[model samples]
Target: MHHWRIDDARQTLVLAATGERLPQVVYWGPALPAQENLATLHATHAIDVTGGMLDANPDLSLCPEATRSFPGQPGLIVRDGEGTPLLPKFCYDSESNGNDLRLIYRDAANGLTLTFIFALDPDTHIITAQTVLDADAPVHLHWLAAPVLPAPQHSGEMIDFSGRWCGEFQTNRTAWSAGMRYRENRTGRTGHEHFPGLIIPCTGATNTQGEAYGFHYGWSGGHRMIAEELQDGRRQIQWGHAARMETEAATQFKTAPLYITYSPSGLNGCATAFQRHLRDRIITWPKPDAPRPVHYNCWEAIYFDHNVPALKDIATRAADLGAERFVLDDGWFGQRDDDTRSLSDWTVDPRKYPDGLHPLIDHVHGLGMTFGIWFEPEMINPDSDIHRAHPDWALGGEDQTLGRQQKALNMALPAVRDFLYDRMSAILREHPIDYIKWDHNRVLPMPDAAQTRGSYALIDRLRADFPQVEIESCASGGGRVDFGILQRTQRVWLSDSNDALERLRIQHNAALFLPLSVTGSHVGPRYCHTSGRMHDITFRAWVAAQRHMGFEMDPRELTDKEATVLRHVTAWWKANRDWMQRADILRLDSADPAVIAEQQLAADGARFVVFAGKADTSAQIAPRPLRLTALDPNAQYLISLANQQDIHHLSRGTPALKSGPVTLTGRYLMANGITLPWSFPDRMWVLEGKKL
Candidate 1:
């Protein structure tokens, strides 16, 4: 037997192989002692054979084989060029181990090679694993999973995400059983309906305490996830590109990186690891040292009605409201007056901008804010000039149903990517633009890995040519969000629905894997256009302030008092953004189910801010004391109610926090927690704390 182990500060994963068979992960959890013997541990990891079972259990190898009669879902499924299923039994060939581990296995009889690669980030505590398959001849791949990993037997339930357009990141909890909890997203993009993430809490794990494991399949292309509990009591998780995504036969197939982490300190531990890994390691920021600017997007404000003078006036007002980056959303190009036409034309609409975009961009610049424009390069309207010229360029059958009056451009074609790059590059070359709101408005007709790869290529090319230009991945908001898309973009439009009340829950839940630096949360109009629910300026602005702060509403609609409140919140966001950008968003466990609260704890652990949003009415009469996390119990902190002025006159009793700032130990604060003045539903409370 051969055994190997990979260790980081927080976790360790051990793999073992018998004879020349492929290796399997035998142990994965909290950091093990450095002097422990992996070989002895692997030997002890085996189970006894039962009456109804075979004499010995088949190894759940890196690529479990149907040839070996493995009872669980195999790690791979493939066929020859003629569509004949080939069940090759991969054998251990070679291995490489260091900070990263690479193991190769070969099936000489079938002329196939299977490889598993693993890399652990020491600081972020995230483990990245992937699988690659190479064949001597062309083959058809039905499914290719990333390096398969064992699921914790102690985990009672598994949490996966599923939701609709505005309602993204809704968690679905499934109890562990003797069968598979299978989920597949064939929407072509990382659909809002099925986010590629899973969290398994060991037994009684909560958001703040206990042990948990997190996994995210980082692919913008559609994906499939399997959480299977075999009859032998072994559990495994498999994540890969959606089955049959590769339409054509090929010699090689590869799975996207699967990020894994084990958290002994509960779900927040997993959250922080993913957050730091994405922000500090995965993303390539154009201006690393610059603060995340206050954003102002125009989609909700004006829709497709683009008048140059009106937009200029709006830009000025947005700047006055403390917006440092003005993003001109959709309908800026291709004679696009509405969503019905001019999608892939990719040229400035002469009707909308008589003098090109210079005057408006200049006005935005004059107001001391950078300019950004929108583009939907991967889509085409049937009536668009480009679509008219190249009808064959669109993907799927001609009679396929349309979304948003448009079809996805055939991104797999080189000509299509070239057309988008050329048109987008021309605009960037001419305009003094620093950002692009790269929007993918609709899902593809079918899931295709090549199409997703093609889209990545175009964005990669654009990023290379204009290294300074930032991109925001917006797929009708939250549809295309994942580490794969985030690799090429700087920000993400979290949701199209700018309803602050809706956003409070969305942002809170999304904090599991998203950081404030890339999550774009915008304050919408007083009367939300999507949900048609009106919210107070204080509540709206604070909700926006929770992440990458922005405003999507018409500044002209804000009353004098409303504008002042917005400006104050915007200023506060600006002041705290420097540290908040790198801060860890810790979701607090609210005793009241009605409240959604989170603490943005600074990276250095010196300060933090808590946003307690009362999403609905509480069952009890008074407000519950909200507890904080990741604090030094012995340290004293100076706590103050940041939005004490927003306290309504109906709140008669003066709570200690309502009157003035209080100095308290972290122990007392975390144990007894901080109680605030009573407030009605739809309101929010902001509390600031600093180490004293």
Candidate 2:
């Protein structure tokens, strides 16, 4: 067998090929020494079988061939116009760059060519793979996957996420059982039900120790991830964009790239590597040097009761509470007083804004805060003027299901795409809009490739024309949060539910891949609109301060006491926003499930912030000693309470926490955890420390 291999600093990928069979990856993980021979290593790991053995050398699953007996899912599935399956066989050609590798195969009988490409990021150990297919004549492609690998041995449990609108990013885990476990999202867009990332923990792995492997898909449209266990006790895993393909003349097919990474230092290590890669490579931070603005969105504050005078009052109060951006959410344009009608109409409602939004925008600007508005350009109500005028623009025929009283637009059509883009562009050109809260309220039934392509084209054109305007992606909130969408927008609304308790967990899971700076977290009203749970104002503000801080409540209705807390929280965020944006997040492990802790350590080791929250109390009354992570052990530090009121209120019915500044070495703090005063349910504390 001929062999080829690529080695980055931390990992290695080895490929092998026999006479005329296709090349397959035999080894991929921790790096081996350069002196070690690839051929010898493949021989040592390859399974050999005697007569009548189903697990023969080639079929023993070193990464199966499409037509062979590896028995899991195939990497490629296609057929010709004559209804015959197109199974690609090996061709004798391959090539490699320094950290990239490519292999070519073909089915000459079917006039089809298949090529596989792999690239590695040296620093983060992220390997990206893509597949390309070329056909001399028309073909029908049912399913095409990027790349597949044998699941590593000793991997115990699989960790994934599942949720709905208000309950986004709920973590789930199940034992790595024997059959096939698959996840497919056909929502036309990344749905809030599941994120496009998965983590497999090595046996007995924890948040801080052992090893973990991660997989993430870069596609934003319909996608699938599969984990199949074979009879021989091996597993195959793969992921890619999910599409229905029928070849056209002069058209080529390529699958979206899939990314994989491994870390020996466990889940935290995996998170740090991904966070670094995303912040440095995938996401383009708008105003990187500036702190994320403290926004006040009017969705929950005033809902559809948006009048010029009422909005002006909200703007004045929002600015007084230190909000830097005042966003008028929904009901400003069209006849959109309610969700039942008038989506495609882009003009401002004449009755609500007789002066054409200028007076309100001027008022917000005069208050020293930027003005932003909401737009759901890809939706249309059947009762709207645009829909009545152009009835063919909706996704399905008369039998289509309506979401939020609206239907999806047929973005695949050029005329429809042009109309939406022109309407949005005209608004930007006429108004001094600082930001746009772009929302998608529904999912397309059978979305076509043209629709995805058209959406990208429209966004790209809008960005090119208005480079200064920032956009936020919100699909019922947190429905479309992925690297693919983050490339065009600056921030994502994490979830529709602003319940503080739910957000603590949602934000924690999201921070696994996204930086807190790019997640939109806000303080909601005492009675959460979605969850219907009431929380203390202090608890809500403390949680929201960790992300791109915003307030989603009517500030004018806040009592004097609540107003004071809001002012304090905003002031604290302003003071620490610089370090928070650039810090490395560390999720800490606690003995109690109800007690969650996280720490943000500055990149330069100068300062750090610790957040300890208690969602519920246990049988014991005494508080446990909390140990901090990600600190310089040798350095001395001065620690103090960030908000004394937090301690005063939280410690009211329990033991009193010692006040005043304390000095301790980082080594001692990490090894021997600090014991704070007892706190009850629905309480949180913020502590800050500086190097001494």
Candidate 3:
């Protein structure tokens, strides 16, 4: 349970608790208010959020997040001398978040006391708790890695990038690094298993007089976050293990459907700022229990040029394998084969679908699956009818029209917005398209190719009018990804690159800013798109960790063994979905070749730790120290599992098990880890440590 209080100005809702505040997130703009001066928060896995107890937009007023604190407890009802206890503390050291609320419990229990600072729009705040349970109904005791830091305070209406932050010591753990040191694999592209996308950059060292200890990274939007080193060179990022839950916003007059505000402050202020911008940013799902689709796409198997029947065959096979959704890639749209013309058609190709998309969709639906189509609405081809119809709507001059793919559409015009709106809406309303893979293929072009107020205004307009539909923003991959789109779309296509190695980097890089829920990742078989570098099929499958997961391959192309493995893996993922969503992600590897591995567990002690030794595959017999402080100190559990070779060569190609808590002594776990008789196996392997 989470609680909050607003300040006297009723703007910032000071967060009281949120465990280990290292949550990487992105934001689009200020919240939209339906009524006046109230905000509403949301909880996932729940049925619905639309009810009588909510508002449209909350006030995203400026408040101190880093330099502030919210004083309160979940079950404690201590009131102000004369009134109710406000969530926002009168005095603040900096922006604060829900981390304080979480740490309160930890501190009370003698566990490590974690602290986080953040700012929210005066209107609303949201807290999401890890409600995942183990297969047996117990919570897996997962390890927490992200650290909490002060939310930057930029001089703006809404907090954005401040560029620099100070004030550490207050949280006072006094462990880890002493000064500030930047993390090498901030993007997590190392292709390691156990720690695929961990971006916990900066180690704390002693800082001497605040002499530049903070490091910065480029954000998709103009927004960015900073991790400053204090007088002691301790490197810390913004608020950690984000448990988002904020107050409900009151109704306000309607303006825009949703409005996202960018602070010169950067992305760190997003959640806190969300408090103010809650009302309109609220996207009520038509069906609360909308099962996140189990999907397979053609992009990986056949890129943009894949023919319709090939795609349909892929869809048919995918459906047979329990996939619920099928998405058609490019090439299917307009005269898109060579990217020369036909984009404006927005119509199905005659030769491809003969009977139009309805038939292809019918075929997919007939197989008891939902159909999805990909579209690049904000773009237009030079040879397109719409572009030729209104040449003035395009951004470039005579013949020099920027052609990232054919001629790009100039989205900066109201006419363009209307054109896209009418075309897209009509398609959705008329088709059996249950899902849409909305993509934005190219960057904004040398910056100013658009004739209107640049791309920002265009995006804003499209977002405002494009509704009742699911949209995804793709920048020829992950280039233009940001929170702005998240405010309007259901998910963002993470990247065009699908190679597992590339994904290991891309996903990690993207997760540094966006939440896992919105990052669409496909388990590509072998390897496709991103270099086509093939590793092992199972190794590729291992990359899926509940982030809107799916695949982009021809099911028919899978080997018998590969298919069996995929089926088992998918089943396991769904079974463990709770843990993946609710627990803290502890990524253990750096993408470097010499050393890389990944280990993630849920509440009760169940974890998936994979070690893809990159350096000397010289197997070590020394028991690896498996951290177990996240679990009960005295409770002993058993270890179960074996490497691929051990399973195949020794036990009829299945996991081996043993009884013991993998054996631990004192407060630390003994390293009796993998006793590999050989070097890192060239083949993919798995080791599930079952609790004894």
How close to the true structure is residue 93 of candidate 3, measured as C-alpha lDDT? 20
Look at candidate 1 and tell me the lDDT of residue 376: 86
Per-residue lDDT over 191-307 for candidate 3, one digit per residue giving the tens place of the 0 to 100 score: 111111112212221111111112122122221122333432222342111111101121111111112223212222222233223212433333434556677677667665656
* TM-scores for every predicted model: 0.99, 0.94, 0.58
How would you encode candidate 2's per-residue C-alpha lDDT over 1-692 as one tens digit per residue?
77877777777778777665677677877788888887888777766566666756443322245667556677767777776776665465555565567777766766777777888788767777788878888777767777677777888778887789888988788778789888888788878876888888889877767778877787667777788887667677877666562223323677777777877767776777677677667666556666788999999988998888988998999999999999989998788878999998998889889989889999999999988889998889998999999989987777888889998888778899899888999999998997999898887776455566667777878988888888898999998887777778888998988999998888888877777777899999989879888998999999899888999998877889999999999999988998888787777776667777787888788999888888787567677777776677998988877866666544545322356768888888787766666666777877788998
Model 3 spans > 4 angstroms off: 1-288, 304-308, 397-403, 446-468, 525-529, 589-595, 601-629, 642-667, 670-692
lDDT over C-alpha atoms for residue 423 of model 3: 74
* Top candidate when judged by lDDT against the true structure: 1
lDDT winner between candidates 1 and 3: 1
Find the number of clashing residue pairs for candidate 1. Answer: 0
Give the RMSD in angstroms, all C-alphas superposed, for model 3. Answer: 16.8
Winner on TM-score between 1 and 3 is 1
RMSD of each: 0.8, 2.5, 16.8
